[model samples]
Target: MSDIATVVDLLTDALGADAVDVDPASLASASHDTWPVSTKWARQDEHPYPADVVARARTEQDVVAVLRVADETGIPVTPRALGSSVTGQPLPTRGGIVLDVSGLVGPHSIDEIDMTVTAPAGTNGGELEDALNAAGWTMRFSPQSLYRSSVGGWLATLATGQFSSRYGGVEDLVVGYRVVLADGEIAELTASPRAAMGPDLRRLFLGSEGTLGVITQVTYKILPLPADQRLQAFRVPDVPAGLAIMREQAAAGLRPFLLRFYDTDEARHAMADPGFDGPVLFVGTEGEPAVAAAEMGVLTEIAARHGATTLGPEPAAAWMGRRFDFSTVEKRLDTPGGFAETIEVAHTWRHIHGLYTDVKAALAPLADEVLVHFSHVYPQGTSMYLILLGQVADDAAATARLEEIWATAMRVCLDHGAELSHHHGGGLARSPYSRRSLGSAHRVLRRLKHALDPDALLNPGKLGL
Candidate 1:
């Protein structure tokens, strides 16, 4: 029998008829990720509905059953949590099955003594944080996707948040996890304040891109809500001057709750061209009111030396309003012939200016127009987020343009010696350049995939697995 027929039979018997989405229509939406560029691939990339089945997985046993079918049929499968991914990470490539775990959400549970929360991967970060904050606690991490993005996807992509300069990231805050491996084995990261025991097994799947495993649950350390908070804004003459202001703040060790920089193009679009006219810097400070005031002075002082103009409280509130929900740009992409997207890359303090210069140099020629914005500050460095706007006549030309821009952007990041991805996974679009950043380690990663899932039955097209 063909793999499709064989796998369908197994899924029906294993999961019962209720869990499968046999309709060709329902499965189509599950097959593609959110890339305007992928509209180009829509014709050739018609992913076959796996053995013609989509599994609604809930319990651990259900996941294991799905994996058994994956290994038996040599078809691929990818797990889904909260369904908030922009990059097609949750979409099943080669169509073995989309093991949807959104139904397995756990009840909000918090431990006041230990200051930790244990919950299923299906849980939403914003929802969990709301509950915690009501009880006089807080989750410092706030990725731009916070409103809709889940804790699991954020951790899977090594996501950084708006307050990354203070709270660190999902990896540093998470102390434990329940991960289901590709071969159906379940591994739990032991709960501990800290461990000297071997390498952190928790980190193994932290940013593994759903290729290594599917995370089922997470337990994280929590911090107390601050007594005071403040957000401030500054405008710089140009890119170099804006970056210099950031470096000066970092050098002085004034780590604000939020430290973000936006280029002129991004600033103009965001501020409705007020004509005050310059790149913008935003810093959020929170803690004791006295301490918040001190940090604000430090930030304002640094900007003055660099010729940056000050915008008072009103602009800061405006920036905070649209800090997340970047997916609005996708609305433009949805306009039949319109296309828009963003790319984020990271590097250390020394290479920051050079990386920014090269990335624009590479992508500008390919795109009709390119805009860069900075958010999610950290002691190590910043994340450069790129936005592209293009209008294409047909699928063929759109594909060519996307390919060119993605390639040029990847080259610029690598040539300047920055990590290919700061938060987002390589997805199918980013996988080709994985070799550039990962090198020989990429080969070993493939080997690990073979050992754990020799059938290549898990998220097949992503990260080149």
Candidate 2:
């Protein structure tokens, strides 16, 4: 039998006939993800890189079986969960086998005493959070795709939540995880609160985007539901003014769960208040009630010093209610000639404003509407999100325009000495510029890839591997 046929039979035998699917619909769906270009391709009835077979794994052993077959046959295997990656992180580029792990979700456990929750990698992020909340706890990692994304997908992409300012990113919350290597070797990495080991190995696969191995299970640090949460909005004079307030708040070592600042255009668009002028800043704090109140007081004083006008809690409360809503992007992408995408980059406070201004200006000609926001703030730097919505002549034109939009944004970001991606890990969309973004450090990734996945059989063509 040919390689494709042989692999199909092997996977079917290993994972059972019912678990292996080669239908046209399955192949087409496995070929792409929520990437805007893929949406355009779907609109044009194109299955550009459909995998020959898709193997749905219901257990960790199923994942190992798929990897073992790929290792023996030298067929590329792309591990996927939920397929919610907007950057094509889970696309089956080499067309060998798409390892579906969305069904592996099961046997969840929460350790309230240790403040940790462990679950299968395929667990839905929102479902996990809801379960934790029921137990009087929370993960606090609320990405925009919370309801649509998977736990493994979040760790694979190094995702950050809207409340990243206080809880940190996925990297911070990961306590331990079990992964199956490209060679079918299962390895579990864990550590205490801190370790002085040779290297923090868990981080190796956290942002590897499934290019190195398949994450089968994960343990994340959880927090008790906050005692109090205070959210308030402020209107600032401009982007710079709002940024200054955010900077001061961070520099003061005040940890507020929310510190989102939207530029004038984005503030108006997001709030749906065209009449409202200038930029808007949403500040939220939680923890002990007394501590939360004190932090809010400090934040308010800093904003007032920066010439900000308090807009009460309504706007902030409204945002929290629908923070996970992605209807706007969905509506645009589903439209015949419409395309929408988001690019998030980060830099220190010094160059952040310039990066924002330059990237928006660079993307202006290609996109109809470019909205900007600074959401994930830190003491030294912050993340800038560039939301692009535009319409082209047709689906074909839309695909090309979206590509151009990404290229332009990455170019300007690189020019400003900023990281190409803040939390949305580099997938096919950002693979081409991985070298430029990583500079000489690119070689380190190549070396690691060779060491772990010498055959290059796992999620090839991503992270410039």
Candidate 3:
């Protein structure tokens, strides 16, 4: 029998027949992510990295069993949820087993006293937010993929939401989580608001992209829903002026719930009204009425200092109404030989503009249209997102162009001293550059990978592990 057939037989014997799926359709579906290159390759009817079999895990015990079986049989295991990852995080690169954990949902609880919520990792992000909102509370984690992303996926990728400027990323909100190690050992890491515990074990798993272990459950910080919310829009002279405003606001300790700066190209594409010509800045503040009003006042004053033209709240409100609409991307990709992708990178205030300019210049020649935006701002730095769209002669040409775009963009980011990724984890798309991007720190990551998963049986070929 073939190796994959033998592994499937072993898995079926260990788990139930219902848990093991070897259908060709299932394997093909389990293979790729939303990665543009992967999608383009799919257009050619090819699944280069197909999973051998899919194990539908319904509980933490099932996850343990799957991991144990994989370890015993030397099969690489890739944990998956919702399949919404655009970075190829869930792709089974080595054609082993795809551990589908979406079935392990429910049995969640909220602690109003402690202001926290706990749920299985497979729990849907949007459902959790709805539950919190019903109780007049909020997780404040609203990524574009919230409706499709799972808690475990968020933890695995260290995701950041639209309101991350105030609530911070998944790393900041995740108080604790339970993980199943490669050897099938289940471990829970928990802590209070602040801990003197050595090393912050949670950090090791956050953004690990399933290289170390499988996240089974997560506990996140929660807050009372904001009593007041405000929105405003402004048009700055150029990208640099918008960056200056964001830097000043962050440095001044203004914690706006949302701060979006779209370059001229992105503004033209994103704004409902395309009359305004310059870069557009959207500012949102939410909290107690008095506090929100005061914060809006300061934000407006800062915009005025940057020579911004007030465009009222209509544009910002419009953006909020359709923030999750990815129809444009879908429509673009549906066109023959058409492709689109987004690359996000981060740099300190001192080098952000240079990084932005260099990357934009480098990608402009490769793509038909290149749009830029700055979001997830921090006191010391911010992330820049570049959206590239183009059309080629066929799938092969599209795939090659997609690769060139990624290579060029990553090269520009590294040369300019910026991180290759901000919120999106380094999945297969960025794995090749992970070592170079992390520099000397890559050695430490390798050591951790060796210590945790010496056999490299978990989510291989990701995060340079």
- The best candidate by lDDT is 2
Q: For each predicted model, how many residue pairs clash, with residues at least 3 apart or on different chains?
A: 2, 0, 0
Residue 121 of model 2 has an lDDT of: 95
| Weakest ten-residue segment in model 1 by summed lDDT | 43-52
Ranking of all predicted structures according to TM-score, beginning with the best and ending with the worst: 2, 3, 1
Q: Write the per-residue lDDT of candidate 3 for residues 1-465, one digit (tens) a residue.
A: 238878888788778999999999898998988888888877788898999899999889999999988888888999998988888889999889999999879878899999999999999999999989999889999999999899999999989999989889998899999999999999999888877769888788999988999999999999999999999999899888999999999989999998999999899876865575779999999999999999999999998999997889998999999988877766667777888898888999999998888889899999899999998999999999989988888778888898999999988888987989998889999999999989899999999999999999899999888
For all candidates in order, the CA lDDT equals 0.75, 0.90, 0.90
* Cα lDDT of model 2 by residue, 45-109, tens digit: 89877888999999999999999999889999999899999898888888889999999798799
Q: In candidate 3, how many clashes are counted?
A: 0
Cα shift from native, residue 423, model 3 (Å): 0.9
Residue-level lDDT of model 1, residues 1-465, one tens digit each, is 246777778887888888777687667666655655554455445553332467877666788888877877677787776655655677665666787776667686788889888887777888888888888898787877776777777777777777877777788788788878777888888647888788766777766677878877788888788999888788788988887787778778887887778887778776657464668887888899999999988889889999987887667778778777565566656655566767888887778888888788777776667888776566667778888888777556666777777888887787788887777777767877787688888898888778766766677777766
TM-score of candidate 2 versus the correct structure, residues matched by position: 0.99
Model 2 ranges with Cα > 4 A deviation: none
TM-scores of all candidate predictions against the true structure? 0.92, 0.99, 0.98
TM-score of 1: 0.92
